[model samples]
Target: MAANKILIVAEHAGGALNPSTAKCVTCARAIEDGEITVAVFATDGSSVAAQAAALQGVTQVLQIDNAANGHPLAAVLAPQIAALADGFTHVFGPSTTFGKDLMPRVAALIDTPQLSDIMAVESAHCFRRPIYAGNAIITVKVPADLKIVATVRTASFEAVADGGAASVEKRDVQVDLPTHTRFVEISAASSDRPDLQTARTVVSGGRALGSADGFRILYSLAEKLGAAVGASRAAVDAGYVPNDMQVGQTGKIISPELYIAVGISGAIQHLTGIKDARTIVAINKDAEAPIFEVADIGLVGDLFALVPELEKQLA
Candidate 1:
């Protein structure tokens, strides 16, 4: 693997592009601002590749079209990606589920040292990242000649703005896929609400709400503000909310324009996910809850009483 140009692998599902790919492209460009190419793998990578090309700072999109790659994974997509990686200086990806699974296979396949969850690029081979559940930040570097493979933290970089007149090109690569990981039906959530991972505003509930019904405070507040719903680890562990809504060290990290924490006792783990939020608002019965330390707006009151009042006033 040679390090001459940075290559980003575009991720998608069912023909639609994932915004993380745009964010990854932005991140990669910020790191080196060098010649950048994106590879999209699918039954026909044409659509997704074109979408990648529309993003700013992208040189071109390489499409790997194959029947076997209709549904992509390491057993399938890695080979196509590996074939392209040898010609690049660096290979970057979003630290997503797909990237989490893909980078390891690529590293093993290409036999190069891979970096994960990098938050900042100090140089072509140097980066800053979080560890200890984001309790600490660490910086490290790699050799320029090494195949620098990395999974970038999405929020650390902005997504490329739309309307860039980037050009897309097609590639003819043979995708040999293994027969594994049955493709089960894809189910969309019933609610028309925005995805928590990408939403700009998030309203979270905590265990102070005694039951699942208590969690509706988030939904109500989120609806009023057109925000996404989130939950504390205690709320998820107690079955008052789904794990998808959990925001903590083990949960998804989000950097929204605003975050409202309802009844959540501030835990270091919980703070790690939401610390980057532009503004933090906390409402808890305990006036001295740790969440207040980081919250820009603090409300100490009974959530049951104050929440409905807030919904009424905002309405």
Candidate 2:
């Protein structure tokens, strides 16, 4: 395609830019040489726009400041993004809840197929993604005539450092606001631990943890190691942790430097989430557990006894 410019839909909340946007920029860099522009939509996006402008490879930051953008409703935001997508060959977003909900709408409005969870950039028109819950990798080539709309898997790429001096430009798009969807109060789980998607270390528990109280051990170890707390789908279904803490194919995907799985039975669904982790440590009583196959370190023992000793040793 002659148009080499790429537009990234920035992910941000509470006036701060989410780290995933920088990762999307990294993915964009893997594509052919082009100008990278990050688009921020918010009531007061100046703060997040400034952060987006600092991403190492970004060429420009487009700020769409409007009260209607305070809560990113796909119905409302997609039209604006599609409008800004003019003259750009690629439009990118992070493969996150925010991106999952937004990008498809933008693609539909622009009459193009949306590529989800792209893991690699083979070329400007070709990409790689995971299928069958990450058990298989599939490469796809987009039609040269269509503008590419894709959501990049943030875990597969590292975020670019904050060093660029990309210029910030304001855009005023005119679109009809949808009355069917409106912003409502958002209730987010508050925690002092690192974000699960971006943490360097993660300590996760499974149904074997038994109860919510059983998760306290994992929390203790996570705190000692300055890690995020994660839970398998089984643990979340068993009510051991909130759904937000789930780490699996049906939950959040993470690629931490170190992943410590305690009492997890290693379901394929769960493995998909941590497949990109640099190192995996499996702690389960069953020596034949599927997790042992992929773990860099394996310990066949009772977590109840092992976790406490680990915490004490670290202490």
Candidate 3:
């Protein structure tokens, strides 16, 4: 019955706060009588910490700036996060690539059980999450005596709007960072399109796209719609697109307002990622494709032909 002292690790890049951090704050707010603190780890975290401090219901922000934190490597961050978890009852991070890589390490360091993909909070120790590629939802509970470390499913929660002016405090965490894992140069595909996770609209292709070149029309259509581009796992496995663009149970979970899936046959794995999308549009030749069962609009036709016509309509 005591107040929950929750510490949320803020995820950021390019000195800007990722929207996922605000979503995590929203998740933390659901806990009864919770006092939330956001911890920002960066080379110079003032900007990101400031953003975290402005989210509604945030009580405090801890800004930890160190030259060693120039890149967000899990090996370097987990120790520092564990060192800061002394008095906190719960530790939370967004279930993002950043958090997915870091939270488990922190859990290992702190020797606490970590729950993943928390979609709903029933109490301080109880939560709801999806299982079996999201075909089923299950409730999980952690012991009240144990410190909780978990990842928030960002797609299920709305980001808290900026209204509060919580105070930010600089904290110097003294912990030995690992030297075994070094930051090598990152090789990421650069695109001008909106971020796949946060974009309001997304257009995805599947194995039926056939080849990388076959994806050009999807990109063209995405450009016309001013939406982000995504791909099914089958498309990524077939090398028609990069794995970074893959949208499925094994890839990114997105909640775009409008999702247009072209040539995707609606495998359950792929469907799990877009279940939260507000409107789904499917275009395929097969009338029996499972995607139509969930799609708001269905077009039974050849994508190569239907897509061009759809693009022309958008034009």
Candidate 4:
């Protein structure tokens, strides 16, 4: 493999590059003396390719435009990515839902081990990742003789700024795609608040929110602070919100600048998602709630009273 040559698979939709793509580049830069290139697969990826080219530390962007890549089916995309894996020492993608679904298939097709949720790059072949719900950290070293495929945990690294002038190139690769799968219509939740994973401030509620209407108070407070709204799995299981709003070990992991948990008991599973947050503020009437163990600031009070007062003060 060429010294320090990395190929990053871009995550995008509707011709716009996802922010996680830039974070993947950040992880790539951590590699000793690595030159980074981004790959975009879509029906018309010109717009996404152009955006990727502007990411700092990127050497180039590879654009593969085809109707077969319209929806990013793992079965269809893995083969295409594997065909382009030659000549690159490392292949990376953001540790997002998209990456989690795509990178393992690419690794299997290329006959290499796939590293998931990589938090740090120790060297070209050595990396660090979390295990056991983030209770422990483990270092892993892959075979130096084989190609490396990795998914970077976007929350662990800051995204690189977009100011570079990396050139975009077209790549034509041929692969056999499965006929058993097809793209279907997507149903996405609409929200005016910031995206939970990328938000600077997040305010989350738990089962104590009681009902869907109770969650509206959290939303109101979130709007006042210009924050994203999240929910614990307990809240979601109770049908207070859609599953997409869940934040926990089995849900979307977030590392915001500020995380405020209201009416939450702070289970270990929920704590794993926000462990990387710069500041954690917990408000629970139960002084014995486990969330206080990790919170930088703990307020032992009723969320119903505390939230309204906090919102008024901000206003």
- Top candidate, metric lDDT: 3
Tell me the deviation in Å of residue 240 in model 1.
2.3
C-alpha local distance difference test of each model = 0.83, 0.94, 0.94, 0.93
Q: How do the candidates rank by lDDT, highest first?
A: 3, 2, 4, 1
- The number of clashing residue pairs in model 2 is 0
Could you tell me which residue pairs clash in candidate 2?
A: none
* lDDT, model 4: 0.93
**Each model's TM-score?**
0.93, 0.98, 0.97, 0.98
Worst 10 residues of 4 by lDDT: 171-180
> What are the per-residue Cα lDDT tens digits for candidate 4 across 1-315?
438899999999988899999999999999997899999999989999999999999999999988899998989999999999898999998888899999999999899998989999999999999999999999999988989999999889999998999999998888777878988798889988999989999999999989999998899999999999999999999999999999988898999999999999999999999999999999999999999999999999989999999999988
* Backbone clashes, candidate 1: 3
Output the TM-score of candidate 3: 0.97
Instruction: Tell me the tens digit of each residue's lDDT in model 2 across 3-112.
Output: 58999999999888999999999999998777899999999899999999989989899999988899989988999999899999899999999999999999999999
